[model samples]
Target: MEKGQRMKIVTRTRAGTITGLMVVVLVLAGLALPAVAPRSLIQDLFFILTMLSLAQVWNLLAGYGGLVSVGQQAFVGIGAYAMFAMVILFGWDPVPAVLVGGVAAVILAVPTAFFAFRLQGAYFAIGTWVIAEVTRLLVAQWKALGGGTGTSLPREATSDIMGVELIRTLFDVREAAARDILAYWLALILTVCIIGGIYWLLKNRLGLALAAVRDNTEAARSVGIDTTRLKWAVFLIAAFATGLIGALIYVQTARISPDAAFSLTDWTAYVIFIVVIGGIGTLEGPIIGVIVFFVLQSALSDYGAWYLLTLGLLAIAVMLFAPKGLWGLIAARTGLRLFPVQRRLVGHDINGGK
Candidate 1:
């Protein structure tokens, strides 16, 4: 062996490379879906992307940050309302209004964290739920936004939305088709950004510190890691992202109401189900989880109670038998990763060494 042979540390594998390439192909294909897919199909994909984005954000906070929040619908509702208020009162365009939604969520999160952080475990979850309820009640009193009856995006508002005209001209489709396509693209971009941003964070020193904080808070503190600050950051960031997604969802629907916007089942419970059924910690988990969720909804949603029961049982089975999730199972068997963040060390054996 050579005396000065070199070694390499790689974070990605050959299989991971292939997996990544496949993902790129799929994303590119998805971008073109509006051209060939029906309006309903585009809407369906938009729903999946938006939900997946929410699940990914939740997983980052609870699965990785150890901040389990049961009232994420708070941010969603606030964000959606903020956008509605902007469009209705201020005449802001929907595209730029989403940013305001994110900012509003972050603002709401600050006070919320001050209260919720004082509690632990189940108490913290309850604290969040209470906060969400309070927010819903407050929003319900804002008569300008139709009080509780809700309101729809006026035809003029929807028609003049950013990129709608361009999309209509580009695709030679109706106004509704253009809107669906625009929403789908926005959802796709948001999901990719959330997953990519989280992956990048997890590959840095912050990831290691966050992991330590998650495993044992006191232990992390003993090593001088600011566990409290890290947790707060994760919570606020998740809230901000969730708010943006919520606003986008409402924009796509062109309708809003307090109950629907803040519904536990629609915004929080279903998101939790998606994250749990997907693998919790890994980025791929939510990706797989959302796919599974979509399939289940497509087939069993008509059954109502039976559909929910099946989902409940499926989550329980995953928890009991495959605690890591479907993605975890596949990864265990094939060692394939699309977003490989785990580090590995590889080196040649020294010449004539044992």
Candidate 2:
């Protein structure tokens, strides 16, 4: 080592500047999409944003928190139901109602965590599912929202949405197009918040503790990490975020049913598939996974059962060949990370892991 040389210990990625510029360009492009893109495309973007948010939330819980919950649908359904109830019974604005749903999910998470934290590993996963079923049964008893059947948001409620009229005027589109744009905008904001929040969390000290716990809970606890509190906090946070996404989804659809809202396949299975297919532990994994899943759905969904079968087969294939996921494989080969989180000491010996 030369005495005149200095070590540059850093957390910033080599690609950080380029990645930040790319993100800004993408966001600007997305916001202007309605001007050139059709309404249907806007609706599809909304779907992608909402589902992407849900997947990211799920990934944070299972991938980093080591709480592999199989019943995130519980939070989704609870949020959707709460949003509907607020609109129907209390006459709240649909937009604000979505926040109410998140709060409801947070409240639900209290008891959910109390029971779920009692179990470990696979048992915890199953326990969460059971609690979801119980929640569904209880929600099914609410007659105001059509009991077990379900109901659509009244035309008045949908038509009078906060920004729909303004969007219609600004874009010179029809009511429906305007509505889709509004939903798309909300989805965009929410997705950014979810991803950004998770990224920030992973960069902080708690993220280190979370990683330690994920590797070995006992070892983490031996080192004085409050694994229990961390798990509970993560479970509750995921529930709130997932719930908010669910409520936003139904708010745009203007429809809700217990079965559809609480469906394991739509809310939980698909999300798990997205995260697993992309990369479980990495933040960028969900983004890549959701894009791939959306592509498959768009291309093959018309084949009905074939689409489902293909997804299953592809998931199995990825597990067998590229256990870390598609993004993981590429990163391993190229040392690329769209959302880099791992910290490495690489400058020089004098860096001293500083």
Candidate 3:
């Protein structure tokens, strides 16, 4: 091969190898880090997973299906509150309780999708916000759960596990460390499972339909696709995943309240920010964005308001200059992917008439 062709081959090979290595490393690190890392590190990893999951769900809807919703928090709050009700009131195990909360969120999404579907574009956004606010108010006023103030799992509250203990004292560093690590692993597993499920879904016919619907609903429908039904499916799936993440958050933080649980500022902001920065419409983008966001947050948290201001500015910059997002930009330019969800061209068709 000529020098230029040889260099091209070398570049492609290196990129492909590095991409595979990166994915392997990520999966291994997620599975093993909590078991060996210090408590603080494990906690941080858990937070990253939570953020990543949020970004992925948002990407699945808005990025892939063209569903921009400002009220995903409705499912988040539902997941948290449902977990509380199941574990505390019904005396269910935390693990099963989390799944129950996820199911409840999925169930609730039916009605939410029904009503919210009536709106379009900005109207849809407003409808979602209204629905979230109403849900928040209803949960807050229900005194049995904690009303507006909040709800708490008692200090001595124990799940069905006979010998397992709840960590109550931060001063007990060892105990806190143990609990944090366990929680970290739980979050990691949940994140991996959700991402894997998404990957499997996207590789199927539904995934192609979702992509078509996102790119151009009118064109998609003209081709005999059921655009409305596809949107509803995306909505329900997003709600289910968001709710499951909420339960994971509650389990790790060991607390939940209507206000904090349903807070849209960070939840909405992070989801959008992550998907935008990482790359919308690509599964890899959200995960990458989560890592970048968490690192920035941890590094600049001491700066307080400045940290948030920095994030806002960064997000705006990403949107304006790189709408495909950071991951998307890289994928477009470099043609590298950790998961390889789509195929790209490096060479033309061998059988071309030309």
Candidate 4:
């Protein structure tokens, strides 16, 4: 040991640096995909990117904030409906309406948190589900928005959305295909922002506080952490992001129905599956999980109920054999962390000697 030395906290690792470069390359490739890829493939990517965004938000809420909410469909539905309302009612363009959707979701989250935050553990989960159901029912009563049956976005709105013309001009594709490309690009951007933002957060002091709160609420509180505020912030942030994703999803589909918009199976359950199977607490887990999920869906979806059964069985097997998830298991065994969040202390002599 040296008498006079300096210590620095480092969170970067060799693997993470390489992974970051790889991610940049992949993103660039994704941006170029519409130029060469088929329309169906672009649509498939939109699905994957949206689902990944949802899974990441859910992971942030449940994995880091210690808030296990099963009713995230509420935000998705609200966000979609809000965007629909903007287009159908106020005649706003769908592109800007997507942002409104996020804002609307945040508005819903305020009251939702006020109620759901009072409950703990499973009760909190149930509370969220109940709220989502209630919201769905209320939205169904909005006859202006098609009541229970739902309505489709106006053709004019979809045909003339911002960026669609540019894409159509560049690719010489139809309006429908151009719209899909625009949506796909937005999804790609959203996914990257959410992942990058979460990683940055995980490397900061607030991330440490979040981990402490997730691990031991009482202990965190004992150490002067404001657990309530932290949870609130995480909840609202998740709601806004989920809402934005939701809105973007419907914009691409150009259709909105209460049942589909607020489907627990699509928005929440599938997301939970992705996070659980991939690794809930790690950023890399959702990336791995979504890929696995999409592969499984593509392969077994033709089997109807068997597809769900297979997913159920796989999830159960993973839970029993690898509770930490596939990524967690891999990281534990190989000591490989592509998204290193743990801070390490490095010491050097004040005179610059190592």
Candidate 5:
């Protein structure tokens, strides 16, 4: 103990520095993947990146904001539908229409939060799902978009998208394959932005307020934290991101349907599984979870019902044994944190006591 010593707050660790370097290298590789990788591989990566983005948003809602919404597919569906409307009705390009999807999701979130925020626990989850179902029913009635059966992006829309031509010429691939590459690149960029943004938020004051609210609402309120506002921010942000992801997904597929776009199993249930299996509260959880899920899906997809059963069993086993998730267990044992967000105070002396 020295009188001249002072304490400074820090959030970085050796592991985090190393992880950041590794992430940069990985992202660079991902950016160049279309040059050498097979089209199938690129498609698979698009799936992984989009799913990871969805899982992270869900984690932010349920894990950080204490808002467990099971109707997230509503945003995904609405976003996709909005993109479709832009392309089919107004002759807009699909690329820019994706932004409209995000805006649409935020629009949906306002009324959704107004209603669902009043409920608690399981009721909130159910209320969200109910709202999604209603949205789906309404979307199914839009005859211009093929009514209940859904519709495809016009041939011109898909063939003449913004960046597909550049990719086709540069990579010397067909229009379809070039579109895949473009979508894959966009997915990579979106994922990097979402993950980096969330990490940044977690290292800032808003993250502290979010954590306080999540841990104890009354306590955070006593300290003058506006809990409702925080929750709304988290909800709306998640909605916007999810919507963008949804629109991108449909752009890649060049098709949209009410049932498929709003599927609970695809958008919400699977995302919840990813977060729960990977570790809900940590940034690394979704990364680890999505990898595991993709592997399982690849191996067991042929088994149909058994595949789902195995996933359910595995999730239950993890809940019972790991509780905090696979990454949580690994972190507990190895103290590895690729994305460290917790603050620590360290002492240093004025006399250069390094």
Candidate 6:
């Protein structure tokens, strides 16, 4: 074998091992979170997982699919409200209701996609925001589902049997802690699975086609790729993921309101901040962005607006100095990948074995 070929083989092997270990470690950490974390810590971790999922879904749509949407809060609100309505009006279990919320969001996404797809570029952004506003108004006027005042999950709604002291006693301390931990692990696992699912998609033929369309939609269509269908498919998938995360958010918080549910700032600003800071296009970027976001949020929890201002300044710096983002910068320099999406030959086999 040629020297170059041998070196290439070694490099690929090393990269594969590194990638495998990174995933394994992360998975183990997530699984073990509940057992180790206290009740208070578990809540915060749940919030972080929620943000991570949001950042990831947004990254998938904007970074890879080239559909820069600014109104994912539409799905978030839909999911939250769906969960609320189910628990309040229909007497459904919150666990199942959460999944139902996601399904409902996807249902809404279909018509919304039809309208949003009619617009292109910045117009689509505006269309999404407008659609969200309209939906919020409609929900607000509909008094059946809390109306303008919004709705809350009944305290007793989640129990298997209403006001069962035995159940409460069983779940009061460690049992409740265990349940919270389980929820955290569930979110974490789903987040990792979703990321892996997206990675697999991008590594496949459809992903290549999406990339082609993103590179040049006209050219992709000329080559027989259905750009419209592709966009809608991605839009729906993104909606599903966003909706699921939204449900997760409410599940942890145990409450919902239109102001909180439909707030674009939570989904848009935070996801954008996470994606931009982490590196928009790469698989690991959102993860890094979430870490940075939480770090700042934790360190500056007391400083309030100043912390936000600092984030803004940092984003500006990333945009100016590292347009590709933090993950992009690190990937460019160190060639390290926690979840590598691409593989390339760095060398070839030599005439004789190394």
1-354, model 1: which lDDT tens digit per residue?
Answer: 445556655787787789778878988999988988999999999999999999999999999998889999999999999999999998889889988999999999999999999999999999999999999999999999988888887777888999999999999999888998999999998888888788888888777788888788889999999888888889998999999999999999989999999999888888888888889888889989999999998899778898888888999999999999998899899887877777776556533343
How far residue 94's Cα lies from its native spot in candidate 3, in Å, is: 1.6
Write one digit per residue (lDDT tens) for candidate 6, span 1-354: 543344441223466577778788978986665454568887888888888888989998999888888889899989878877888889887767878788988998999998988898899989988988887787788687778777666767644422233433544554345446556766887788788788788877778788888788889999999887888888999898888788767766666777788887787888899999999988789888999999999999999898889998999999999999988888789977666556455543333334
Alpha-carbon TM-score of each model against the true structure: 0.94, 0.95, 0.87, 0.97, 0.97, 0.88
Residue pairs with clashing backbones, model 5: none
TM-score of 2: 0.95
Model 5, global lDDT: 0.93
TM-score of predicted structure 4? 0.97
lDDT against the true structure, per candidate, is 0.89, 0.89, 0.78, 0.94, 0.93, 0.79
Clashing pairs in 3: none
Model 2 scores what on Cα lDDT? 0.89
Ranked by lDDT, the better of candidates 3 and 6 is: 6
lDDT of each residue in 1-354, candidate 3, tens digit only = 333332211123465568657767887877666445667777777888888888888888887788899998889888989988887788776667778778988988898889989988999998998989999999998787889988776554433232134432322345446556556667777787778778767767778788777777788889989988888888888898999998878876777889998888867877888888888888889977888798888899999989888888999999899988888788888777666445333433332322
> In model 4, what lDDT does residue 228 have?
86
Residue 191 of model 5: what lDDT? 97
- Greater-lDDT candidate between 2 and 6: 2
lDDT of 5 at 183: 92
RMSD of each: 2.1, 2.2, 5.4, 2.1, 2.0, 3.8
Error of 5 at 97 (Å): 0.5
User: What's the distance in Å from true for residue 141, model 3?
Assistant: 1.1
Minimum summed lDDT over a 10-residue window in model 2 is located at 345-354
Q: For candidate 1, give the lDDT.
A: 0.89
